[model samples]
Target: MDAKTLERLLNQIAAEHLHIDTLATRNSDRLDFHEVSVWGLKEALQAAFTAGQQSKQTTQPN
Candidate 1:
């Protein structure tokens, strides 16, 4: 992937992670990022990474 696209993906991942962090912070019992499961934060990130990979693969060569 190009530098710009890679940077955007990284930023998106960071924002999603921060969203999970915000959710945990809103509650009394804090949940760890590792403690998540299917359909959770990690799953969301995994899907994003997969889609990003697919997009990169399918993108036209410069």
Candidate 2:
């Protein structure tokens, strides 16, 4: 797929993940609280994704 396609798909997925994470944290129970932090995971994943996008954006056209 093209960069534009991938970016659009990733943006949608990332937005969904963020929304879910916000909801999860807003009403977290003791059981879910001890589990992995959704924000941390979301942040890490977003950081990596952003880096990849930046790299792609900065690449010289062949």
Candidate 3:
């Protein structure tokens, strides 16, 4: 998908799995940083991958 759509999807995944407001880091500071467990990271990655796969399936022509 396009950049905007991808960003939204990533943000959604982060919010759902990591309890993050958004993945867009606005500044180089503690507030912008997060401490996430390996499991949480894995879950978010899996969600993103699933979203991409679903997007591809819908977009590809038969």
Candidate 4:
């Protein structure tokens, strides 16, 4: 995927699964830092993986 599409996908996943306001991570060290449980991290990773799989499927020629 392109940069804009990837950025949107990551933001969507973070909002849905990590409760993060944004993935910019450029505000400040403290503001960018987050405290999350292992379960939440796993959920976010799974969501990202699922999105990747779906994107790959759609972009591939049959």
Which model scores highest in TM-score?
Answer: 4
For model 1, residues 1-62, the per-residue Cα lDDT tens digits are 78777767665664565444332244344454445445556756786779677887888686
RMSD of each: 6.4, 8.0, 1.3, 1.3
lDDT of 1 at 59: 88
In model 2, the worst 10-residue window by lDDT is 17-26
Model 4 ranges off by over 4 Å: none
Off by over 4 Å in 2: 1-35
Higher TM-score: candidate 2 or 4?
4
The clash count of every prediction, one per candidate, is 0, 0, 0, 0
- Candidate 2 residue 36 Cα shift, in angstroms, is 3.9
lDDT of 3 by residue, 1-62 (tens): 89999889888889989988977778977768999889999999899889989999999999
* Angstrom error at residue 49, model 3: 0.7
Instruction: Give the per-residue lDDT digits (tens) of candidate 2, residues 1-62.
Output: 47786666655554455433332244547523534467756774886588677778878585
Residue 36 of model 1: what lDDT?
48
Root-mean-square deviation of candidate 2:
8.0
Instruction: Kindly give the stretch of ten consecutive residues in candidate 1 with the minimal lDDT sum.
Output: 18-27
lDDT of 4 by residue, 1-62 (tens): 99999999899888878888898868797769888878888999999999889999999999
Global CA lDDT computed for model 4: 0.89
How many residue pairs of model 1 clash at the backbone? 0
> Cα lDDT for residue 21, model 4?
84
State in Å the error of residue 45, model 3. Answer: 0.7
